[model samples]
Target: MRLIEKVWFNSHPAKYLLVPLLLPLSGLFWLLSTLRRLSFKVGLARSVKLTKPVIVVGNIGVGGNGKTPVVIYLVELSRSLGLTPGVISRGYGGQAPHYPYLVTAESTAVEAGDEPVLIQQRCQVAVAVGSDRIASAELLIAQGCDIIISDDGLQHYRLERDLELIVVDGQRLFGNGLLLPAGPLREGQWRLSTSDLVIYNGKKAKKNANQPLTMTLAATEVANVQSGQCIKLLDFIKLNPSVNAIAGIGAPQRFFDTLKTNKFNVKKQQSFVDHHSFTLADFSDFDDTIALIMTEKDAVKCQGFCQSHWWYLPVDATFSDVDRALLTDKIKALL
Candidate 1:
């Protein structure tokens, strides 16, 4: 783990010792953030409202709170509602030839980011990547998308959103509950009160005034990266007695724990930083004898360099029927 990540997520005395030093910076960040939001609220800064309503799926803290799966589920729900939906992202770690790049199934992760390409590949919906969320949404609208889903843009005030959905990590709610440079929160804990919905990505618990809905990422199937053949999780585990698991996500332990839950004999494990670009050279230590398993997010980036033994397990976001109905009602109200 990176040094800052270690400090931010740390729960022991060491983190407490260092947090005091960062409190001043965190206070400054809060001030700037509040000022920026006030600028939009007071008309000092402009927030563009598109023709179609926007649903933003984001988190208050850094690191992954399983927002991607929720975004995918939202896309499916949008289609089921008979509304053509498109996605817009900040294109984190992606450097395309130009701005507002539309992602396709064949698009490389390096070109349009790992999450956008994965969403396009899985959801089969139009996705645009750019720093300017408004421009990206415009591109999606030009492609006939009637609604927009902004991935990880809750704090982005420039693009006005009708529905704000805040996702939180159930295991670690807000780490130390301090602001940036001191704790995991990008915004203060009070920000949760303003969200229309709060979804916990793991074990659910009552927090403050909001009764959070629960969402779980369930492994559905495993597919061969080169052959495109899929098999049941049990069948794949039975077939591969020993394989090395590789993950380049925000939380590698979560993916690893999922593999263990499915009874996979993980002979070895490798974890990379979130959105780490990969090449064949990185896998040189592993021979062709053992298979290399990865998450669907990592698989998108490695598709360019074909690997015969490389495989990725696909997962779906699952929620209770009550939560599903409530979410559906909320979206339908917008339409």
Candidate 2:
């Protein structure tokens, strides 16, 4: 992790000096964000409500709280409920040819962003990417979608939402509990109460009054990045007792820890900044004999140039029966 992130998430001594230095900037960020939200509330800024109900799955913190997997789970749940769901994302780290690009079988991560492509490929749903989420929602509506799911836009007040689901990194819940620059949060902890539902990624918060739901990312299988062959995670571990792991997600340590939990002998692990564009040169030094494993998100960006030994573990968001029923009932009510 970078020095700033270490101070944000970890209990580093640098926070005593670094946080004080960045407090002014954090105050400014809070002021601007508050004003922007107030603008929408008071009609200075327009907030568009789409024809279909829009569910926003996001977090207050800057890093990944396993929102993508939860999004995929929602898409599948919507399908099971006989509703067609579509996703809209900001397409961070991707410069598409135009606005509101629809993800297709041929769409590359470079064009549609990694998470959008991954969702489209996994759920076979209508996924759109652009800065203008309203335009993206219109595109999905044109495609006959009955419901809209915003991948990560809780703070995007301009696009009005029917339901807001905030995912929290339960283990690292709002480090320092301060705003950006000084902490990892984009908004304050109070934002959680304003949200419709709070989903804990790993564990539920002890003192939360919202009666939050908890979800766990369960590893299902490992697949070759180059080929389409897949095998059970344990089977792959049996074949390759020791492997090298790499992750480019916001919380790379979570991916590494998942591997360890699955009993994989991780020989060496590497982490990169979130949404990092991978190249063949990035893996030049890895020993080809031992398997190289990565998160499914990273695999999406590396598939075109991946070696035969490169593999990726795919995880699914699993929730308890009561939580699933409650979530389903909430969605039904919204519909």
Candidate 3:
């Protein structure tokens, strides 16, 4: 883990001593972030309102909070209601030849961002990626998408959104509650109140007047990264109790925990930084005979040199029927 990431995700008594040292920088970040929002709010910087409603799925914290799963869920929900949904992402850790890279199942993670490509493959929806989200949204609009879902751009004030869905990691809910280098928060904790909805990824909702909806990442199946063969997670665990688990996501422990939940004995676990580019050399030390399990997101980047032993676990974000109805009704209201 990187130094900042260790402090950001993990809490220690030393953090209280070290966090104060970074407060000045965090304060400056807060000022700049606040001013940027004010620029749009005061009309100094204009926000473009698209013809279709845009639902933004994002988090105030820096690392993963399972926003992509939420986005996928929204897309599926939209389709059930006869609305075609498109996705736009900032394309983090990806660089394209040009702007507005449209994603397809065949699109490489290098060309389209990993999450966008994953979404395209899984949801089979129109997905576009670029730093300029408006341009990406325009491409989706041209592709006959009725609703636009911006992934991980809650603070992109330039793109006016009808609904803001903020995802919070139930375990690491706003660590330290400070901004930037000092803590995990991208914006102040108060930002939650301005959001249309708050979804807690994992853990049950805390009882409060405005209780946030809860969702859990449920393992669905395991697929061979090279051949596309799939098996039930339970069956996979039964067949191979001792396996090497790998994750290249922002929250690697979450993936490891899921494997444990399914009774898989993860004999060896490796964690790479978020969106780390993988090479065959990275796995040279691993025994090719042993089963290697990875997250679906990481599976995209390793397909070129993946072995038959390599497999990935695919998971779905599951919510209660009542919560699903509430979220669906909220989106329909925007339509």
In terms of lDDT, the best-performing candidate is 2
In angstroms, the error of model 2 at 108 is 0.6
Q: Which stretches of candidate 2 lie above 4 Å from their native place?
A: none
Rank by lDDT (best first): 2, 3, 1
Ranking by TM-score: 2, 3, 1
Q: Tens digits of per-residue lDDT for model 3 on 92-168? A: 88878888888877788888878988999888899999999999998999999989999999988989999888898
Each model's lDDT comes to: 0.88, 0.91, 0.88
Give the best candidate by TM-score. Answer: 2
List runs of model 3 lying over 4 Å from the truth.
13-17, 207-211
As a whole number from 0 to 100, the lDDT of residue 204 in candidate 2 is 68
Pairs in steric clash, model 3: none
Return the TM-score for candidate 1, rounded to 2 decimals: 0.96
Residues 1-335, candidate 2, lDDT per residue (tens digit)?
Answer: 88888999897999999999999999999999999988988899999989999999999998679899999999999999999999999988887999999999889999999999999988889999999999999999999999999999998888989988999997888888888899999998888888888899988654562658889999878999999689997789899999999999999999999999999999999999999999988887778899999998999999788889999999999999999998899899987
What would the TM-scores of all predictions be? 0.96, 0.98, 0.97
In candidate 1, which residue ranges exceed 4 Å CA deviation?
Answer: 209-211
